[model samples]
Target chain A: MPPATVPDATHWRDVQLHVVTGKGGTGKSTVAAALALALASTGRSVLLCEVEGRQGIARMFDVDPLPYEERQIAKGLPATPGATAPDGSPRGPAGTVHALHIDAESALLDYLAMYYRLGRAGRALDKFGVIEFATTIAPGVRDVLLTGKVFEAAKPGRRGKGARQYDAVVLDAPPTGRITQFLNVSDELAGLAKVGPIKSQADLMMTLFRSSRTAVHFVTVLEEMPVQETADGIADLRRTGLPVGGVVVNLTRPDELDAEDLAQVIAGTADPAALAGDLAAAGLEGSPDDLGALAEHLLAQGRDHAERRALEDSQRALVAGYDVPTYELPRLAGGVDLGGLYELAAHLRRQGMA
Target chain B: MTVSSTDPGSAAARSATHRRSSHRVGPLAGTEGPAPYLDLDALLDDRGTGIVVCCGSGGVGKTTTAAALAMRAAERGRKVVVLTIDPARRLAQSMGIEELDNTPRPVTGLDTSAGGSLDAMMLDMKSTFDEVVESQASPEKARAILENPFYVALSSSFAGTQEYMAMEKLGQIHRQAEADGTYDLIVVDTPPSRSALDFLDAPERLSSFLDGRFIKLLLAPAKGPARVMSMGFGLITNALTKVLGAQVLTDLQTFVAAFDTVFGGFQQRAQQTYSLLQDSRTAFVVVAAPERDALREAAYFVERLADDRMPLAGLVVNRAHPHPPVELSAEEALAAAQRLERRRDDAGLHDPELTEGLLRLHADHVRITEREAALRARFAATHPEVPTAVVPALASDVHDLDGLRRVGELLAPG
Candidate 1:
């Protein structure tokens, strides 16, 4: 499959799922929440899920612990005009958007109970600390359960089962480094557990994950390490034949200086005499040391400007190499909050990510 | 390289060299007066230096730095174990291991043509917690703690549990290494969290959580009304009972009751471990990338270490982009690009597009260099006394032992 394009609210409507992963501090949950709100605004019943129980999404939406059940965190805000009801029906002002924090352990227990006809065994295992061992001690099992829970949530169910599930499932997955493993653990475990129900389930999970319906969006800062990790994560996921989606380069500094301007600032070879004249005009007074310090200060400012530009350029270059459509999210001057998430969603919408 | 302590002139010169050198050491230079890079060789020279703790924020290559340093020590025929908490599979892949959990696993491919051995383990957080409870608690107590639903939830769900367990794990590893007399050095990679400073506070946090004042109060017997009136214990106990459902309180009391016997030993050992980290032989390498934020985090970490009197070993800035010196002026490049753009318009000149792209690329490179320089300046200002080093951005992903070796080479003594 071709690399998944970064979805705006519109694209999100077409695609039924979105997965966000990044480094721990890189704001994956925030993006997932925003994407959900954005998609919901476009008249889709969006389900936002956080598998790690970070409660970050709930915090972002100003809600308490989002229970295991999906709750409508926001209706279509004015920003997203087209959200709809559950039945492929038109949404009025009372559109629906839901959020859930997947308790991975609970989900794993539930999955085992439902699928393996091992509910009693699962309960016993949990009592004997086997559940804890499987969830936390085992490397890939948690990832498998988490991914399975998310995948299961994405599909639409029969009418009587529930409000026809979610139109789209947005997963705030594990960090980028472990995301490929998290998403592909079922296959890994399947290899380890051949000729079993788990193996069959893993096969199905892999098939679902590899399908076109699934889209993985990697959130990253425009810095060296996170970007590198994002790239590596993308490459690794691709090797597993998973859909490699777009890169969201978060917290990019604004393009404040152009090349020529940046160069002039850095060279210190710029006509200091002219800059001194400008400073004098601007009513700054100084002795020769003061003037020299002033000039040095100006040069440093110029250098800082150049550095920011370079960082952005490097980030763009790195993202460009992936050949997946990359979206740049500008660094907000203030800390990110609910309003900021909404603003980001709106920006993405404008860029055709629905 | 050795300057005599009595040679005043040489010492002064050496200090000056260190100052100058610190400025040159990536971002950590210049901001702080330069000290030489922490001499691990010297630290371990005594054979008494048992543990080296590498602490810093995330994405700093703390794991790689820890591995490299441990490898360096191990290569010198010192049996070494590098304990890392990085959740990445690459940690095992880097050490050429298929898997590593809470248990210390032998690292393959460390038999450097020099006949030394390296061992590595990824900190399995939950397993470590289980081990702590298993070791410290009586069999019945362990069963109670393990079986309790709240205990299971709190052990995994509580914030800072990982940090507390990490300390416990560190102590375990250190004890094992010390007893074995096989490993000369044990290196630790800390989890990246704001509370990563937890190592400093872990003893108190663990002790308090286990059997501190709150738990002690819970465990106290219900007093008669007259006795309660005398101390006001009843009033406080009533408040706690109300806040935590009676059952919840009972569960906690049961857990703490089981844990009470071991609490003193745990606290004392924790204090000892805390002191152990502060020892001269245990150096703290603050690993960070040269990014503005990471460096800022590093600055805060370094200052915190300094404030706490923790031995600041050195700084390792990893994945630093190497900017090639600018060759062409922006004006000239722009002009060339414009000319190329015209040619492309006229004749679909691929060469012109190439030139234009090259110019833009150069311009981008210049910007990156400036940012890197500023980072270096900021780091220098704040941490001028610390010796620092930069690990250049590697072209390939560090997935295997060879990649780690390359990283080790960069970290090795020049």
Candidate 2:
């Protein structure tokens, strides 16, 4: 096994952009939200953005659907005891999380208006279906515009007034299968627009994507396919010379049985009579047959649990082979509401992911 | 956000547990249920059902479901072909089609006692597109369109290309099946898109982009028949050139002009496939996990299918956490576990640690089952007309043929 480069207090402290990608249904949006909250400190304005126009962040925070504009969605979680400054003082108050549902057409309009000041011409382009073609049908302009918006948010400075400068930007990018091509915009645009503003914009985003200030984290569940995708995704990111970040193992199940009990359950040596006697001794009202049935039920569930635990262990071992700092967020019993989001943020901060 | 108490002793949780246990509402609780069952065997046995399209959100086991259905159907004496858009490496190997070169190869090691056969293939999107181009255009014209920079970009990495190519391949396979009688059943696994319905919409999206007035404007100069419309078209072209660079515009115009001749055929084929999907012979099986987002996507797909007047077969809720077939309430289990803990603390005799752990695990299992049941019930309430088949959560991932067969058994159990 490779020696994993574990994240420390200073590891991601200086990152200006955090890109979170994962297999679908791995709770990638939730992890990105938690990471944004983790990175948001006092006086730090973290921008959480979704480029797929899914309005996932808005739904996650239980707010109205966010427009293309960046709006403050929620306040960050209060700094945990683990989140201390260099001198061991408690971190300041929680910061703010602003979210943007960045759609390609609006971003393209914004880009053209900003770069060429072609207000009427841009509207004409829309009338001609050029905006639709560019954003949806064109090869790579949609990604270019999407990442360009994120780049604008994460860039260091601004020249105009009212331009919001974010301390950190968290993007809920596309799925792992398309993530490398999504982020490596330069290569995506190389064949089509080699000398255009879009090409340069893609190149600029590529620079930030490959820099130390950026980290692309992956969220995955402890399943075979998701882990396999994460492994392949990380390798793809590394091969493209992009900055790879830590892995956040989301929705992890807690072990209910210890090793001996699990082994006995798996081996079918669990004493059902003892279990029934224990149930009867615990003051449960049941007949002998009922007790036997209940004991069998519990043993069946235990065996399933044991098997799942074995699978999860193997998957975790596979994740460990990636040699990156890995953090785990437990599966919330109830669904992830806002409070649960804060709980996950606290877990990330405790793991020094901020 | 209010921090709702997750404590087992909380009044809300206890009451909820009582409600669930009293009603026995779960995937496996067949004694008290009106939840509809999707008869996979009947669907597979039907000779009129020529195509089955499996679609849903990603990570919801759509590919596995499609593969299992094909395997089961083929082993039951039907000639089956499964066109999986993207499958895991082990799953492809299990089907004996490790080479995903976009051809349907026969899967060996099937039971064949029923005189059944299974052929599996993975979609290679680029090759599929190339085949379409080669079939549509003359050799030199196809070479021009294929080697064009814009065509390369559109075919290789365009947003809707995979979905489009999947549709194209489906159409090709269906035509060949009809002509040669090679296979009677084709099970299609849709591409894993942000929206599960992208495959259904991809053919239209691509054809519209190709047939739109914008493409006409770009091809006006190349076709040399737009002398009357040049003034307005030149302004748009100049704007496009200023924005996308002159060389980029020229390449696009050239590609569009070359592709224009072939796109009419493409559009007609896409139309035929769309009609094929809406035909009575095609059945749409919406697959989802018992999670909220996946169910929500399933709901959207169900509504969309209804809107499009497509034949809705049923829903397959995969990886459902079904509680053990016992009348144990979570509240009662927790109370018993707490009583055991207290007795152990007081006397230290009868060390009921294992019993306590079992009770807690059972309580946890009950809670999970209740939550999943609620999610499924919510979906059912919205779309009660749709039949559903809930597959229990397997202890391990399905990789090999045996595992897939286990899933098939669970899917349509007697």
Candidate 3:
């Protein structure tokens, strides 16, 4: 139950689609990007998709605003040859990576064209604001369209013969609060359509979602609220029979005090006169009262750290109770530049996540 | 303590001292230049200030800040109601209530020395929407609308429903307060949308969806002027019928017809609430942490508030890491700790790890403080006019009233 323990990553080679979601401000997008990079570096070509239109990918890469089109965003270091799955899917080799910002409106336009083959009628609908209706006013339709794009990208031979296949597709999905509704969108549409092509597509999507090939990972911090949310989110995913993946505990701060120091803080057993003597020896000149203040300050901070570590222990236990692999990323104190993103990817790789 | 406006000095110097003094009063000293002091005490204590909206991206302690503000305002003798959209159950329980619902409930164990009281409610969006419809539409129409499949979906799980309901609930409380003075201050915690503007745009979006031409055309087949239902509409309806089928269309029209009667009331009420948001008495407190994305969102909120001419009280940078009170550089701390480590390893010094750990901890503290100061400086440089108040990171997550009181003290240290 110790925090920042990067457990063995049960390797997601068999999974095709990875949806990363968590509480807001839990670094969901960053975790998704790192997972994508890790998957790609291990020799599996990958696609990174963002559906909420946050432009988070572009910002993380420090690139110009990406248009609503699929394009190459990054390249991974070549992977050495690796094991193959039982299905004869070659496991890991050096791969290429691409990104797509899934625009709901554009997806709707494409969806209508694909299904109805309505060239002029599509334009008429767009003019008459039916496109807007489908994109906006229609409650569950936009989510379906956004999700449909991911399905096409993940499906083999989706772009016709000789089309590039993605070993993994990473979706930086909505936060945990809305994730169940977002992924269960097919069920939502089923309630509406009853028996149409919409229902059939939804059924297909739900099947894909619940299968072993799909996994939704929860990213969270060790704080009480996010940990509580992660536990709740995992339960919801399990309740609906969605494939739940491992937990990515993001932004864990490094330990600043060892066990003895923590014990002293917790037990209130530090000798004041001895601390004053040590301070004088260390060239920190202070009267006995001044030394007392310094010792008190450090002890207070130590006690605070002790409390946080204890709380984090309970949170880690809660996550462990779910019986899934858990990986941790330390709080990057160097301002989270592109280098930090790679550092996180390397951590995931070391943990065998990819 | 209030950053003296009477200081006759160079503008920059006055502002610098102002910034420094505010930081020293609370937790740490910031080297960042003078952004105006937010004066949270003044903002909360003023009788004219009625509404304080806390908004940011998710997980930035917006709820904690709102709850603390409510407590502070109440203790300051202004009756307060804090409406949080979906707080964790434990948090509600910590406030001495099993759960918060649509109705405001009195919170016990307050100081109440100033004859002030605190009321808290969690915004139940679906129930609020139902209440809006029940109050605005006739009973039969309301019942019909509530039961409609489309209406049920929209009211419960739609994208814009929560935001619209937040506005609706705010308007409801404001109206009630203005009439009978149930509370003088209404503190709101907004939805955790990716963009803060969602709270501002949701009502407009719902209005557009209802009043849009497609809806008019859908309803036209059943009830419309012959001229309005031209040959063009007939062609569009023919295509729509093939696409959506007749039953779905009928459901939508029936939902819209019953919904349309109260749709006007919603739009007008939303407009009124939007105006209230823009009023001088309303203050937008954009909350963020010392992080890149959160501050980026905060900047967007600042620009949006300005664009809409909303009165921005200031920015509240929560969870700020404060530097230690004593002056010690990271280099000095690290050097001292290394010497102690050498002594411990070579000469068997007493409690070596503890002493060394203390120094190292101090070093880490200094480094984080420097980094956060730099980040704050960057934010200050971008939007210098926006006043700011900083709250240092607490040791534990805030739960009960005592935790909130500590937060309130830091929010505006007397």
Candidate 4:
């Protein structure tokens, strides 16, 4: 069955901006890329922005290092009559995916130029070191500049010839430990800038965030720590009144045991005699001792599997309790590659996370 | 800033224990010569090694490894202290404490009869920063800087502050060891970041930010003369006003001024800490999971540490899948499983499905075990000079002293 959250379809699709975050190491960048791909796969153009200077998006797309300018990495296909995708997401003709690696220093300069029309002074501002100090070192404004870039991209496109509208803007934001404080721009700038064009910009950003136009999606694994962070991160977003979107649990292992076997193993009551007999019938034909050893090994493995499922269930319950929509991406036995990334995007599309 | 005598030129450490595994060859044969495996127990037990810093990206179990190492060191009789920069409460709970503050707390239930003791503390990055500020600055100035909105924001959750403060805290603990012999060894769990090098670079970044010409330029509006500077400052400030507004600029200037007096001290302290880390007595243990991305990150850590001249102890590959004991090949097992399933009704088998399930699980285990082995071999091939240890994935989440003890034993198993 489709996840309860995605049934409305438009619940996530209608929003123009989707900010993706999670605990560190949850593949947040990969998920953001996949979401952008999935959104654009339906013929809807999307922009993927990464703020951390890691150049992760470049590596993800297997392209040369991405500069500050927006570059088209992938184009989506519109849905075909019966097109089968490698990752299993339904596919057709779609729009393109353009990415921007937002450097805080230049982005701050961009913001300044946008408002004050500073050209030579902009380059001079960078030289004089105010840009680096404020954009890189200054607290609050650094994040504002990063998220501000996303907000600027996600705005309703300008009205004129060559006006390009984005179906969604996906931000590979800071990890959970700092995301809330990073995204809470109004509160941050409100305290610092009581009244100015900067404060007005902050106000505009917060207005967009609190509105339905923005949704923050968290990427996580079923592991306890990342799961806890996922729950906590969502609560932080909610506290700031930023829209909390679906939870994308990454690198999930498929359950090997069904409910019946799991219950038996959890209770530690699986029949050893039966297991040995079955092994013998299958041509092992070993002594009882060897058979018993085999049975014990199988039981231990089954027990571990059962215990993990139980823990995963509790972790899933934690996310489920948050009342946010969630999507699970299966663990790729072979590590993620360009093809695997598309597979994941197809998976996300099938699940309607786009 | 005092430069250590050792800083001139140190080549990449060829200290890796496992030499070329000539027996195996593939795409992963890393370009290298042989090196020694890391002796974690010996490193912990050695009096010469004063500190063990576990550095890695998140979800790699660095905190657990640090705790286990500290526990082993204490049990081995080296009054040890572990400082965890991780925000997770697992360390406190595992040590049987409700909360771990900036100050080290003695852990109970350790086998101290051998004369070793373990003390654990969670690094409250902000509190640690405040403590440093409070100790460094006069009372009035400390208060003003602490309450400043800019300072509050920067100190609390600022990006680089935690790593900088961790370095400071390490220096503090090391100094404590020097003074009254509070603890001889410190095992630090570095903060989780997009890049582990941040731990090595944050203090320098912070120091540079404080001492950089940009701050002087910002102060030019108030500190420098107006005749030559006013025109340029005026244009910049005019532009800054439109972006940051005049009020925000004033708040920033106020924070920098209040924080100015300590710039020299901050720079000196950061340098001192860097020198201390580079000292031979300090050991850097890079931890990673047995995955491609994690291994790539581990390589980055290893290279950066070498460039910085931090004494490299070795690499710890955590949560690796152990090769299964059964001799049955996955194909044979599957074939047997299919037979059992086909004969479920014909044969008097008690639970044919269970046996088939067992066979399938075994196949998966074998496959996963081979994958993990390949990944490890790949890493070994690439950085054969980095001594390495592989730890099997534990049966459960490590949440208590006993669990940590188990990890400690596995880390350097007999």
Best by TM-score: 2
After superposition, candidate 2 runs with Cα above 4 Å error: A1-6, A41-43, A80-83, A86-89, A281-283, B1-34, B225-228, B342-351
Write model 2 residue lDDT over B1-414, tens digit each, in one string: 222233433332233223333332333443234345567788899999999999999999999999999999988999999999888889888887788689999998889899889999999999899998999999999999999998888888888789888888989999999999999999999999988888888878988899887888888777767887777676777778888899998888889889999988999998899999999999999999988889999999999999988899999989877645677777788889888888876453343776787888888776776677777777876776676787877878888988888898877775
TM-score of each: 0.59, 0.94, 0.91, 0.89
The DockQ leader among the candidates is: 2
lDDT for each residue of candidate 4 in B248-322, tens digit (9 for 90 to 100): 878888888878887778888999999999999999999998777788899989989999999998899888766
Docking class of 4: acceptable
Off by over 4 Å in 3: A1-11, A77-93, A160-163, A270-299, B1-32, B96-100, B225-246, B331-344
Q: For model 4, what share of native contacts is present?
A: 0.55
Better of 2 and 3 by lDDT: 2
lDDT of 3 by residue, B1-414 (tens): 011122223334334335635533331222345466677888998899999999998888998899999998898888999988877667788765455358889988899999889999888888999998998999999999999888888888788789889988999999999999999999999988877779898878988998998888777766747675566676666666656565666787788888888988888998999999999999999999988889889999999999989999899988877656665566666677777766776443457668778777766665666666666667888888888887888878888899899999988876
Candidate 1 scores a C-alpha RMSD against the true structure in Å of 13.3
| Model 2: lDDT of residue A320 | 89
Q: Is candidate 1 or candidate 4 better by DockQ?
A: 4
**What TM-score results for chain B when candidate 1 is compared with the true chain B?**
0.82
Kindly report the fnat of each predicted structure, to 2 decimals: 0.00, 0.64, 0.41, 0.55
Give candidate 4 regions above 4 Å deviation.
A1-8, A76-92, A158-163, A266-296, B1-36, B94-100, B221-230, B327-350
